[model samples]
Target: MAVAPIIVHPPLGTGGRRVTAHGRILGLAYSDGDVIEFLRRAGLPDAEELLDDPSWVTWRGGRAHHYEAA
Candidate 1:
């Protein structure tokens, strides 16, 4: 049996929560430096602007694994 990976949207603000398939809520960090560090490792340049705000949070819902900006 394979455990599905939890889907995470990019951090929108200082903090957020992501619900996993197993129903666990993981805290999403959004400190400017922290977000920058994560974005640096994430390798997505398109999201640079989104990481600047300190009060934005993202999330995805439904049975499907598609994540959209929130």
Candidate 2:
């Protein structure tokens, strides 16, 4: 199965998280639920599935960010 890629940048100065899909910025998220909500708003087919998977990691720089179960 093909998985949709979710990219998360470092936290903003204002404490919001930037989320991206396909190189396009979705929006800023204040929490994990906000991330998922943004993805859903963006119409990503696998948004829920992606977050539901415990193995999924939002990558930053050249490494995976620490996983925090939603």
Using lDDT, give the best candidate's number: 2
Candidate 1 residues 1-70, lDDT tens each? 4433333444344334243323444435333344334544555354446533323323344222232334
Off by over 4 Å in 1: 1-30, 45-47, 52-70
Span of ten consecutive residues with least summed lDDT in model 2: 61-70
Model 1's alpha-carbon lDDT is 0.39
Residue pairs clashing, model 2: none
lDDT to native, each model = 0.39, 0.63
Model 1 poorest 10 in a row by lDDT:
60-69
What is candidate 2's lDDT per residue for 1-70, written digit by digit as tens? 5534677777655566678877788887667677778888887556666764534435553223323333
Q: TM-score for all predictions?
A: 0.28, 0.60
